[model samples]
Target: MMYHHLSDAMLDDYLRDVPVPVGLVARLKQTAVPNDAELDELLRSPPMPDGLVDRLQAAIQDEILDESLRQTKVPEKLLVRLRTIPRARRRSAWRRFAVAASLLVVLFSAYCGSLSALLAAMRPKQNRDTTLTIIELYVDPTHSSLLTMSEADPTTIRFAPPTSAEMAELPIELARLDLTPALGPAGHLLQEVRRGAPLTEDVFLMRRNTLGSPQTNDQALPELSHVRRRQIAGVDLPLAPGYDRAFFLKSGIHPPVFPAAGQPTEAIQVPLVTRTDSVDLTRRLLLEGRTPSPSDIRVEDYIAAVRYGLQASNDQSLVLYATAGPSIFGRQPHHMLHLGVKAPRVQTATSTHMSIVVDVSASMRGDDRIGAVHRAFEIVLRHLGPNDSLSFVAVNHEIVRQVDFLPASGAAQLASMIRDLDPSGGDNLAKGFQAAMSLAFEAEVAAGSARHVVLITDGQAAIGDRDAARMRDLVATGETFSIRSTFLQLDRLISAETVPSSTGLEHASAVSPRQLPWRLVTLATGQSPVVARQARLQVAFNPQAVLAYRLFGRGPTAVTGLADVGVETDLHSGEEASALFELWLRPNGTEDVGWAEVHWTDPATGSPLTTERMSIGRSDIAVSDDETLWPLRAVAIVSEVGQRLSGIGDFELLNGRRFSQRKKPAGWKDVLEQAVGVHPSAGEQSDFQQMVDLIRQLEELALRGPK
Candidate 1:
């Protein structure tokens, strides 16, 4: 075992009372001061380095000399005696002093070792890195409504602004936010304070920008919990509580209302915020009496068109809803009609015979018109059961039989022939119907089966008996042969005048029930009265500001106009038909809107059924207060607005004026704002919001003027 030796300078430092290095002091403190046995063993083990003893002696001497020089109180007698001593005697005294200093230094070194032990025993120990950080969030609902503060982590805090969508679902009127454990040198939470208010466009933008900021820590965001209702400032408020350090609070605000002088005063009830759906939004907007865009208008039209049809029952009778109101411009009255026709039940037969006539004309080449015919054939083929016989005829300038009557087994062959056929030449709708009718008649006589003829055309008759009456007569002739006929128009040109006559054959030409095949008789007898001729609806308006109107929800069916005020459509059993009319009203006029009438022939009695005259007076105009009429009104306004926005110039007087107008109508924004106030269902709220957003965008675009 070897003992470590201390440096001479360190020994001098100990004797002079200079601060010892911490490392040496710790080592000395770790072991007791060297024992005498250890010291003697160390001295005997090795000789000290040359001049080491002298160096130690010199250091001690310097320290002693410095201490003596600082003594100001030297006795005068002792100073005189020291000066009288010889120089040689003084030298000897110095040598003796150096030796004494060396001895004292060695003794002080041992005392230093002992002092280090004492110092270590007195020192306290502690962990320097262990620290606790406290994070807190404080909220006061009474002051801050709709404000939320969250402590995401020890170093991050986030402030969330109230969202419109959220407000729409809350009953609060005001909200404020307050954060506690205020930010300090550690970090900050919110850069700015936000107050609660209606989520306006500007507020929406600010909230969006804030949420997108880089400092926002989405993952650490506190989950907000629903809070119990509380009363603040004498008002009830909704508060949503969140994570340990997050809070959301809101209060309600009631609108002021003034009643007429004669009316009794009543407490006002604020409407609770609720979710909204698409239908609800449209309905609310319309009830508020706002001018709707063309798209909005179309939505109502579509709804009306489909809604009535859904109400149809097995009874073949038609259902109708018609109303009128004051136009936005206040001049002419707006007229509307909702019509539904019940469809005929499907007929089944043991054996079937059919004729499909397709027009392969030049115009049919476009819009995949001919392709539509092919698709129809494919559908027909799939429905045909075993023993069903079918024939295909392609007609343009002339009629050509592509496939003669063949059983369902030949369906693949018929389909092939249809696909191979090409379009050319002028349209001859009359000839096509004639050829199809002739084939259907032959099939009826040969098979004594259920015979039907389906004539597909663009309704552009260019040659060969183009007269509408002649075509109707040909269809009647097929009916006499016990063949039912259906005309499918591929283009918009086909009108009620051109569609085949729906009127059944005269009693004189009718085969007696006794002579008719049992199956045919069974379908016609004891069933709901069949629609003989297609039903016709006549619509007229007052003040004559009507420019044009478009119908929606016909669903692959066609409507032929009898005149501006009337139109005709076919109705089949078990099928629902609906029509939505989009009306263009004239500006700056006033009068009672006109009436509507529906005409149809009862196939069972061969008698006509006409609807009672339904009329609308100026007083009948819809107002926002009527909840029942809101949906209707909304649809109508949306339809009109949509048409206008589309730049449709069909309106006679306003066509040119619309494009050249320098200023938008007054109260436009107010109208939209009022519409926004109406509450809707949740499902439709998003759609309604989108419409509102669109309106705002359009307004902005208009402000920028034409590109």
Candidate 2:
């Protein structure tokens, strides 16, 4: 079994033919072979060319299959079936794969193109620039009642016929008194009389004589001769003797002053009088002729007669005090009503549910107006806290709920929507209010939240109910729902022509045409027109050199430099500032009499600051009954007169003649006398007495001629 040195071919043939003894195999098993380093190196080396091993394996497999076939016969039918199978089908599969790959490539290219187009479509479109104009109508709810008149009927009277002799003498009597110098060119003798200047004795005598007699040169006036007196208010009363002269004098006379055919007459300057002044003069003349009945005066006339004193409340609120006096026009009792409103202060911690309803109607399309609204929204958003909830409703002909009631997280989305908004269509304030109310109701349901709806519009409701009463009702509806509503009317200060040239792509430009070089664009556009000057500069300077500046009635101690300081620096919340200027006495010198002012913008609210002025001569202060109360009294007078003349009050009298002889209520002088008799406080009594004395002095001055 372990034959040594046997030839390799002989040992292989002997092992194949006969099995080796078990003892010999065991001995071979136990024997250890030496390590063949050369053989390991040969194995690690490349056996042959890359495909040589595969080729060798295929050849070996074929040889083995051939040997097996030689040793064992295969079925002829199976071998024939295997050989008949088609091999070309593999080429078909390859072709299908190539077609699928080409299809995928085409689909991918199309997909990429479609995706690019979609992205482009999502972008904002650029449109042409549109110019817009806005007009705001502010209806004060508190003052609406003033638009109506009382139900009481006015008294009427009739005069008796006059004789022919009186008519004949009227012309001669009128000619004796020349009214040219007193009436000036405008025929406003009452205005001169109201100025309270002393009149000349001759002028008084002329007026007395002209009003006392109806005959002159032994002839009766024509007015007396043609006596056709009509009854008023169904009351027929006999005329007093010589009533023609009184009537003629009370009713102003117009005498023609003709110019030569070729000669030009010089223009005459006439002093302007406000409606209040006219009413006052008319009332005074009626009193001088006869007493007015109680029903003839109006509530507004009564209110206008009192002088309201200004006082600041403890909480920095304003308190207006009006001295109660009898009606100046009729016999109406007077009472005082004081109202105070709390100022809005910033509260960062409070949770607010705010619904902003903006009018994006055609009227608000103006860049300045709408732009102001946008800025206001920004300011409001900035003031909102994290706990605050917001809802935005934009209205034109239709209502758009741009943002629903949600937390401050939606602020960014709301702002984006606002920027994209462009004014179009008509205003539907009612629909806007409804949408806002819905939001407010939603906000109300949330616990611990205060609801408010801010309506920012041009105040024109064209597509909806434009009636003021209906609008007020809508506001009342909001109140019922427990939602507080505030209205802001956007008023544009600068005209469209004032704006710089605007290209269609102004929106894309870095700066807007509406923007001035020095300040933000919206500051000047959004604020009240009165503060335009201040919004731009943040400061205003006085151009004139005045001896003194006084904020009258506020006292010299209230502000520093009562006389020297001209510029006003403190202006907040768009409040207006007015000052009385003391100028150097320039008797006959010709110089500009106006005061100069500069205004600037407020950084906090983006509103404008305003400075106003009034010139006061030394004589005015000297002639005033109470110098300390002069400014307040003057302000009260202006306010009262303005209120009455605004047409919201005393509608019936607005169109009446300046010197109507119609009877009116007793003068405020009588009312003051009664009030004084009531034994008011010493201060009140003094003020009342001073007012009475002032009125008497005015009457005396009117009767007498100017010195």
Candidate 3:
């Protein structure tokens, strides 16, 4: 029962401590005081703890027939609940009446909420002007495992409980481009560079390329600069991060943008901005939930697909995280990286053209390994325009011509090369890579383009003990030629090929142990840096359950010893990027969980930067799965939590199933719908109404299919 609305005199008396349970008096205090007769009657005697109010209400009910309750009896349990209230007295009929009245009031409030459209119709009209706020972030792709949710009405929001039909699936619906676009120039709107802000309140200023059209090679994108200030989905868009903005943008025009892969938003061109001005430490309002705090609307964010293990052992202890650094409005990096740390000096006599050499050994002939390489090579060729050139070669028992450091051609020739690949032979990874590097160096000298070598291999060099030395030789060659070597592994079957891989992994830490063999070809030939540089992350935490936490393998990644801490991800050799870490915290003594900070470097120039801080308090909830989600987070959480609870081993989730958004709800649908229903409509009809609406929707819901 609400105590604040009680009669002022009675409330003051209750706070002052007159022993509770004065039935008539308590009822008089909790209910509206009738006229002079009622007032005089209450003054005659202190009300008893029972009977009086019920009798009075019953008498009123008997006299007035219009508003009789179908079930008017008040139970002891409700009255008992009221007794502990600081302002409430002991259990009594009077307390029961008060409880009944409170319930009635709540029903009426809900009734009002259901008629929001009618109330809105009666209220003054909005300016009809809609402003779109743009947001963006950087992401590392090697280690990330994000999936995209295609259904659940990105256009119109519905008020319903999350059902099995609404859950999102993994690996299948997991579109890396859906949230944060893969490393391409198309999402440049959110991919613009960011400079750090002092990050106190609404003080940080986010700036971008502010384009009106697509940006292409050597050409600046068109610009539309007047900032529009309208709240999207109950969230205010100002110059602010994810909260309310300071000004109103011109009305009626929709912001241009699209929900980036692994990011938020669906509009095109015009960027979307979020609420929080910058990062925060103490607040737990960053991620989404049914009950949002002021801080939740202030930032735009989503949970990461991969759950880091507690102490890097098990994936339990999920933490909620908010958008910060470059990840807020754009795609961010999946893995934490640092490059050029101890890069040897290059004594190049001339600038070299970019080139990559691949290994088409027998080990990679099967299972589309060669196919993946061909696809990557094709994408890279397309990425290059007039002024650029590349040279490609395939190494087997003998070096074979793929592109041969020649100028790229129209799509036809590239396709023929890709389709002609035939893989089979003894593994000679070292020679293949060496020949590729030498060819890349020679191509650079001939064409005057940046030089690089990409090595794709499934096994270590077949030379046994000399394998390590051979790999080292490849790295040294890249250094000597001022070219960077990007090593990509296809399948994990090469675990036995130890020496060559170990040496290469040590030098090219950015390489992924599980990428398709083709990606290596792209990396070696691509111009973007292989890793981000000079990155840092700072996290402020809710003093609740966060007694201590540790970052695994990453340097000093633990925060237990320090009062406050900042984390960083850096080292860029290819294109620039950042990442978001959702840290669901379990507060002490309270099931309410909170999250930590995720920050990174400016992709343009490795510089320290922070994102709008997001914190989600503890929760003891076990969300039911949504069939529509196809077990995205549901599976992620299950795997992480299962590993945590069972102390089992870690495994990568691979999706062999695909579900359509139009398909009937079954598994993932149940997961997503459950989360969607947890959050009240709050009268939000559009996803953009509250920029955090969708993220909140995601936070409230998680889905995983049968293991």
Candidate 4:
């Protein structure tokens, strides 16, 4: 019998099959890779082909082939063949068919045997392939006296590092990584090395719940069971540029911080990297403290941007790479985070006052910005109390329309004007805000109430008699007149006021709560006292090798140990904020493992906010097989697959590629349903289902990827 066979790898890559994550299944020309193992076997099996088979799916075609067909006169032909064949020959023919099936099985597995089964055999009989890492991080209270408050004031991470002797003594199994001090304000981020097949992998943050508490046989944060294939806007980043001392700056900034003890603190220049235009990168980062620019770059572009783009443009000077590698966020908080106002902070029906300036510019015709704006308006309208008055303006060159939702005198006229606000010649947002200020002033005059001017724009501008100073003057005067001018900034604008029409971070806005909705976020969350305003972390141990740590929180800036920051400043408004900090610890040796102290202090207040200490005990915490499915592993895999297949980078990363996350899947809605155990809102059940789908997708990807 003739048999056809193929390897799992060949079938996976060439057959248009990719390993995809579980839940997200939208194949928008940009998503791929994830199918089950047993299911994969069916996919790999060769089938008899026919005209009907060519048109239908493999499974359906199989069913059609298996079904009896034609006039049922099969016995006559079978009887003739049976008579021709000797009884012994007939039995022999059956053995030949069995042998052929065995041959096909061997051929299929010649190269693509099961990875799990092979690894299972190599492992010690008593040992499970999976393992978990648990670390007790703490500091020696007496160590404080050893360093002295003055001596310990960190100018750099190099002043001291964790030692090795104590590390070797820990009771838990651990994978150690190199530790280094961070420069300037950001504190040390702890990184750890995890062994993997494709490359030497590592983790930056760790679990807070597992550290320094009771140990129920504490486990290491899960490792990635397998590598993921991600496509981020189809951009590929080269390793050398980021790790091999390269700097690419499409844009950057220079800040001045003085030195201590008569020492001159040299100016440090930081570069911004991007595949999109430098201006877009700069503007987005400066305003939102995020890489809001679409990631349309190749890994190579990332390398080049890090290497040559960062140098002084004219000189092609290579900037210095910091001790640690690239930040989780490439460029620091220097971009616009606000995509736009996502509705007013409150939709309560309380008596309130608000104003909105819409971007009805001809340019806004088909962008998502308009839809987003409509969404914001809807959310804000929900919070307007009976006593509150909300106003609206559709701006194009000038105030195209205005709606007074309160006074009841001009509501209908305003609505008609709004409906008729067709996209027009240009955007004059400054003028729109001025008019809004005038209206607010008039409203305040008419009735005593809190006055606020909410300016909405793409942050773009078309001049008609205005400048920054002029705009600032209006804002200042309006504020002095007791009217608060809150900017619902949408996009960044470039004009003669900008440098050579260059779009870079050089001229970013220096405002708190950089974007619009954030203002509401701060206001709303501030009402809750439990919302953390400041935190302090104190860590200690081997004071030799470097240690770097980062806190995953929302805000414009990261609080580093070097910065003498007080934790008095409040975080944006929210009932609670949660983050999982991954730490890569590089213990000099097992001997160096011991207790590390972490004290979290606020930036606004020097006093300690949280004084948490964890003591680590070392055992045999080796990286395990279970990590192959950690949620983030799935995310990274999905990212690679998406990027490789389609260039969907911009909003996908921010939205997490629609993969339902466990910790904070979407927002409060998710938190209430999961952690708080509240019933899901109507669509939330679907969200959880989506997460399950993603998990299945991940398993598929793992099974399908090349060994």
lDDT winner: 1
Stretches of candidate 3 above 4 Å error? 1-56, 59-352, 365-368, 382-385, 398-401, 408-412, 419-422, 430-438, 441-449, 464-510, 513-601, 604-707
The CA lDDT at 266 in model 3 is 14
Residue-level lDDT of model 4, residues 1-707, one tens digit each, is 22237677776676676566765565643345455875688788977667765667777866776674642335545789877956563457778899999999998786466766788889875422222222335865333211112223222112122342232212223367788655432222222212222211222222334233322222222211222222121111122211111111221101111111222121111111112122223222322222222332232121211111111112211112111111121122111100000001222222345555676875554333453454244323333344656677778776777765454344334444543455546666767767777776666333445566666555555544344556667778877876766554443222213231111122223221123344433222222222223322222323222122222211111222122223222332111111111223344534332232222233334455432233443231223323222222222222222222222221111121121111212112321223223223312332233333333433344345422
lDDT of 3 by residue, 1-707 (tens): 78868999988878888665759787877687587878888788786778888999999878666445534545456889877667755789988999999999999999988799688889975333222222323634332332233244233222222323452432322234546547665444244443442322222222332233212222322221222232232221123221111111321111211112222221111112111211111011222112232222222222111111111112211122222111111121111111101111112233345556566666554444565566456445544544455666777667766566455455447557756876655456566677776676566354434666666665444555576676677687678756777665554233312243544355332232223322432343343332333343333333244322211111111122212222333332222111222222232434433333333454446554444444443332223322212223322322222122112222111121111111222223433333344323312322122323333333334332111
> How well is each residue in 1-707 modelled by candidate 1, as lDDT tens digits?
22237678876766799666869977877587787889999899997789999999999999999999986455556899988967563457888999999999999999999999999999985423222233334744333334332232223223223223342222233346676776662233233223443333455545655443322222122212222221111111112111011110110111111111222211111111011122323333332333334322223232322222134435556555544433342233344544333444533445777776777866565544554455345435644556667777888777755567777687667877776776766566667767777777666333456777765655554444335567668777777877777655553222223333222212112221111122122332223323435566554545343333334322111122111222344443433433444354445445544566567777668688876766744455443334324344444434433434422222222322121112224324643554465445311433344455545654554565434
Judge candidate 4 at residue 243 and give its lDDT: 15
What is the descending lDDT order?
1, 2, 3, 4
TM-score of 3: 0.29
Cα miss at 303, model 2 (Å)?
47
TM-score of each: 0.25, 0.24, 0.29, 0.28
The lDDT for every candidate, in the order shown, is: 0.45, 0.39, 0.38, 0.35
Candidate 2 local lDDT, 1-707, one digit each (tens) = 55787889988988899966779976776565535786688678965578888999999999999998897645556899988977564457778999999999999999999999999999987543222222225844432211111123112111212222221111111124656555553355557558875444446645655444422222222211111221111111123321122322332111111111222211111111101222333333333443223222222222223323333234322122212111222222211111111112233444677777788876565434565555455445544567777788898878854678766666566766776787776666667767876777866444644667666665454432244445466567777866666555443333222221111111111222122111211221222212222221111112232111111111111123123322222222212222211122223422332223234444456665433332322232222223323333333332333222222121111121111222323224443344334323323422234344444543454456324
Model 4 score (lDDT): 0.35
Backbone Cα, N, C clashes tallied per candidate: 38, 31, 169, 159
Q: Model 3, 364: alpha-carbon shift in Å?
A: 1.7
